[model samples]
Structure formats: C-alpha cells, structure tokens
Target: MDFTYSEEQQMLADSLRRFIDTEYTFEARRKSARQGESLDRGVWNKLAEMGVLGLTVPADFGGFGEGAASQLVVQRELGRGLVLEPVTPSGVMAAAVLSAHGSDAQKQEWLPAIASGERIVTLAYLEPTTRYRPESARASAERSGDGYVISGTKSVVWHGAAADAYLLTARVSGSNEIALFLVPRDSKGLGVTAYPTIDGLRAADLSLQNVAVPASALVGQPADGLAALGVGLEHGIAALCAEGAGAMEKLIQITGEYLGTRQQFGKPLASFQALQHRMADMLVQKELALSMAYVAAQALDETDPAARRRMLSAAKVTVARAGRFVGQQAVQLHGGMGMTDELSVGDYFKRLTMLDQLLGDSDYHLQRFGEVMEA
Candidate 1:
C-alpha cells in the first residue's frame, strides 16, 4: 500500500520528461499546432522506439510488461510537455479496453501493432445525445447471417480521423445489451469528419451506416460490454488525473518564474505578500491532487471495486478542480500577454480547460462518487 513511486517508475518519468523537454518544446508544439496535427509522426515513432508506447502492454504481446504505474508516468510527462499526441486516447484507452476484454486471436492480431505504434486505435463511445454516458449509446449492431451490421453516429471521437481502427460501443438489437466491436478504419460504410479541437488535438465525428464486421470482432460477451467499459473508463479517468496533476505542477512553476522576473509597482511580483500567498494556496491544491492521483493509480486493481471507484472519482475531481484553478490563475497572473497566441501560458490554459471536460467533468464524477458511496 505504499503510495511512493518505485525507483524504476521514477526513472521512466525522468527520462520521459527529459525527452519531451528536448524534442517537444513549445516552439515545436506550436509548429505542429499550426500544421493541424496534434502530434508529429517522427516524435511518436521515437516514443515507440523508446518503449513508451509499450509501457502498459503485456510482455507476451511484445511490450514492456509494465503496469498502470508505468503508464501513469508516461501520461504525467506528456501532460507536462503539453503534448497533443493521441497516445492516451489510442495507446492507453483503446489498448487497455482491448487487452482487458479482447479474445486471444484479437490480442495477437492488434496488440503488437499497437505496441509498436504501427496502428492507432480510438474508442468511439460518445454519441451526440449520450454525452458522456457510455450506457446511453443509441448505436445499434444487428445480427446478420454470420456477422453484424452497425449503424450509428459517434461524436467527439478522439483521434478517430487518423486512427487505424475503432473500438466501438454499440447496443445489440434484441437483448439491448451493449457490445464492443473492433471496426477497421477502411471498412465499408464508415465515414469520418476530422477537425481540430480547442486543445490543438485531432478528433472526428464517425458515421457508421451498415458497417459490417465478422462476429469475431465483438469484444467479450455482449452482456459484458458495459462492465468492461467501466473498467476501461476507470483507467482513462486515472490517466487524466495524472495528466492534470502534471499540468498543474507546470503551471505553478511557470507562474513562479514569471513572478520572480516580472516587476510591478517598482518591485518584483514575487516580493508581494498577496501573490506569495496565492502561489502557496496553488501549491497546496497541487499537492493534494498529486496525492490523489498516486492513490488512484495504485488502486487500479484493488480487491474492492467500491474502493477503486471511490479513489478514481476522488482523484479525478481533485485534479479537475486543481487544473481549472491553476490554469485560470496562471493566465490572470500573466496579465494581457497570457491570452495571446504567442504565450505558452495561453495554450496551457486551453489544454487544462479541455482536460476538465474529458472522461467525465468534475460534476459528473462527483455524482459518480456519491453513487459509489451509497452502493
């Protein structure tokens, strides 16, 4: 039950941080943003080469054979660097979902490609009306002769436009049971509209009109999809919380440096008592959020499902609040220049705002926490 990161985990985090600092600087990130892609293929390949993409994939699948802690380290560094890569959406969430529930053949077919960064997959769970509710999917997969015909529209599919495939959630026709289906990007009757998001990331709206797939495409049993989704979502939320903690830490550092150098009223801003107190408060919030993130990461496979859910929800809520507070304060403290395109501070704020809405918002997760408590 020790909450501290192991030596190996710390090393991995440090290495990733150094790599990002050297290769994914603000200028390079801005350049990629201008080009309309969230990540550079070269950089992504480099990450794969470094074994980052394979951190959480099992060793039997040609991966690092690490666990949730290793993935958390990578996610934290990615957030600190303001990376726009689809690693989390594709590499973590989609990969985890498949690893958790996919059949042996499915694992052998996809996990290696994903681990090697040769294929990208994204979860297409959100619908226009379903909002963040995975269970509310209106998409249907009807049984055909020896396969299934899927018809539905998925909105806000992260990196869906560029993904090699999709891990889709759809309702079965007769049983009303939800199921996960692996649909290739080039499959017939699949349409996609890709665009940039506020956080300088790529997303797409997916239209599946009778997209047919073999019965083997189904992940696990149809009745197990919802439960499997919950597991995947837990991992996703924990990853976001870790990312939010890193971003909050970066915000604090940036603001501290700015206050030390920027003078106001003929003195350095950091010399002011009020600003110092505010920064202290920000640090407190960051520490609490960080602690929660670590707890949630370690609680990933806890015996008590309720404990796991509570820890994950608590971490997410804490991180969301900290992200919003730190982001807004960083911008406000930076004054007029903070909101301009020329400043990294502005980009950080935008990214944090977007993270607040991802997985589930603070309010949404808070209610979930309550539900878990009652249960």
Candidate 2:
C-alpha cells in the first residue's frame, strides 16, 4: 500500500510545521511548563483556526473529516513541536468516539464545539485496575429515577485538567455490560485532582462518587461501551505512533546537528566513525518507525476488528521500541548536557519515554501481538 502523503496532507503538515516553528518555540513551551499550564488558549485557538482541531471530526459536524491519514499529519507536527495541547485526546480520540456513537443531539451539541476548540472532552476509561484494558473497567452506573448515578475512579486522564467533560466507561448496574456516559466536569460528587506530568503535560485523577447524569448522557447502546471505547483507543494508538515517529525523527536531526557542531579533541564529534555508525543506526530506527506509523494509520480503515487490532499492535511495538532506542541515543550523543533542562534534547527524550508508557508499552503490544497470532 502506498503511504505517501497526499497534496492536502502535505499542505497541512507544512502549515502546522511553520506555525510551530514561529509560534511554539522551545522557550515558550518551557514557560508554560514552569507555569504548570496544560493548555495554551492562544495556541489552541490558533489551531482551531487552522482547522487542525477539526481535522478528524465528520464534515457534517463542521470538521474537515480527513480521518486517520490527516490525523497522522497533524500529530507528527505536534510531536515535532512537543506541543502540550490535548489534540490526541480531545480532537482525535474523543471526536472519533462521539462521531461513531453519539446520539444525533449529542453530535449536534458536542462535535461543533470540539471542532471549534471551544470545549475539550477526553476519554476517561483507564482505572487503577484496568491496566490498559478498557474491558476490565469496574466502574458502575446505577439507574436513578430518570437518570443514572455513576461511581468510579479514573487515573491519569490525559489533559483531563482542561476537559469540560469526559467520555467515561462504566458497567451498567445488574448487568455485565459496559456503558458509555458523558460526565460533565461540573457534576456534583465528582472530584478532579489535576497534576503535571514529567513530560510537561497535565493529567487528572477523576473520582465519580455517585455522580448523576441524565439519560441523554448515555452514548449509544449500553452494551456497546467497549466497542465505542475501542474506536477511540485504536485511533489514539495510531496518532501516538505517528507522534513518536515524528519525535524520533526530530531527535535524530537534533543529535546530528549537535555532533556536527560540538567539538571534542579538536575535532567535531561527527568526525568519529563510531558516532557516525550510531547515527546511521538511529536513522534506520527512525525510518522503520515512520513506516510502522503509516502501517497503523492505514490499519485504521480496516473493517475487520481483529485484523485491525493486530496491525495496530504491531505498529505500536515497533514505534515504542524505536522511540526508546532513538531517544536514548539522542541523549547519549548529546553527552552530559543531554539530560539538562537547558537543552531540548532532554525534553524530547522525556516525551518519548512517556509515549512508550502511554496507551500500551512495547512489551504490552508485543504480548498482545503474540496473543493475536496464537488466536
């Protein structure tokens, strides 16, 4: 299959890169990190104006409806810039879930707001016990009069600090079936503890202690919650792989430039044959990762769930492993300064490290891939 970017995709990539280069500098990112700010309103609005926030949503809902391929383009640029926004969670994943399963009224209400970047909604499915398995969520929702009361704890909700609401998962009371609910952030009995992550982003731990919602809050059939969550998870993994590949690619470029300029023993580090070989290896890993990202993106269009999941697992494994290798090499090539806050290399490495742990890690994906093969 051809993985080349279309003209529109290339245009989007170029546009986002230009914006990041001029507006989203490393120093600006550091300032936001120091301030403990997760979402930069100015930047978020600009992204919306650029149509990036709407790239994945259905066109009928005022989005570009560009799908996974466009998502790959947008994510790569965000990764290169080390952006702190919640595009993956709100713009890509949540948009996909809502588009797929939201009621007509829900779509009319949420999709336009999401595409316009007026609101943020992140998936809140990960629990202390779920361990990356949405199906294992034990949160329960009990019918309360004309509504339902939900009780659960969601950990490390990405960009939850800025979310106006959450697309949460819970088991319906008296049944084994999972259900999806739109939990507003202001709901009574809901608790949000926000914190900054090591990668300079923000997350929140959510506590829903009998938080009540109207029946309209339910998304799609109560029994199809896992399937709804799967749409978001799969898209999220693909976007993340693309982001990691971009980060790896940028890290390699930065390391190469550092080797070319930084002198040792009266000669540039790039002159060392050993260092050159290592750079070559980093390049190879980056290329492989980029290819794997494309593979995952392409797999998003696959109609067969098992086959699509297997391919996504494969891509995740390759990208996760490659990210680690490339990140570590970038830091090593930069020497002691690599870990220093004054250098962007450290930040890139940190982000890449967290990316491996996000969604599912290399080992997890490898095991899942094996399981799929066995099955």
**Best-fitting candidate, scored by TM-score:** 2
lDDT of 2 by residue, 42-63 (tens): 9999999999999988899999
Give the lDDT of residue 5 in candidate 1: 70
Clashing residue pairs in candidate 1 are: none
Model 2, residue 359: C-alpha shift (Å): 1.0
* Model 1: worst 10 consecutive residues (lDDT sum): 1-10
lDDT of 1 by residue, 83-140 (tens): 8878887678877887889899999999889889899888889999997889999999
> Alpha-carbon error at 98 in model 2, in Å?
0.6
Please list the C-alpha lDDT of all candidates, in the order they appear: 0.86, 0.92
What TM-score goes with each of the models?
Answer: 0.97, 0.98
Q: Give the TM-score of candidate 2.
A: 0.98
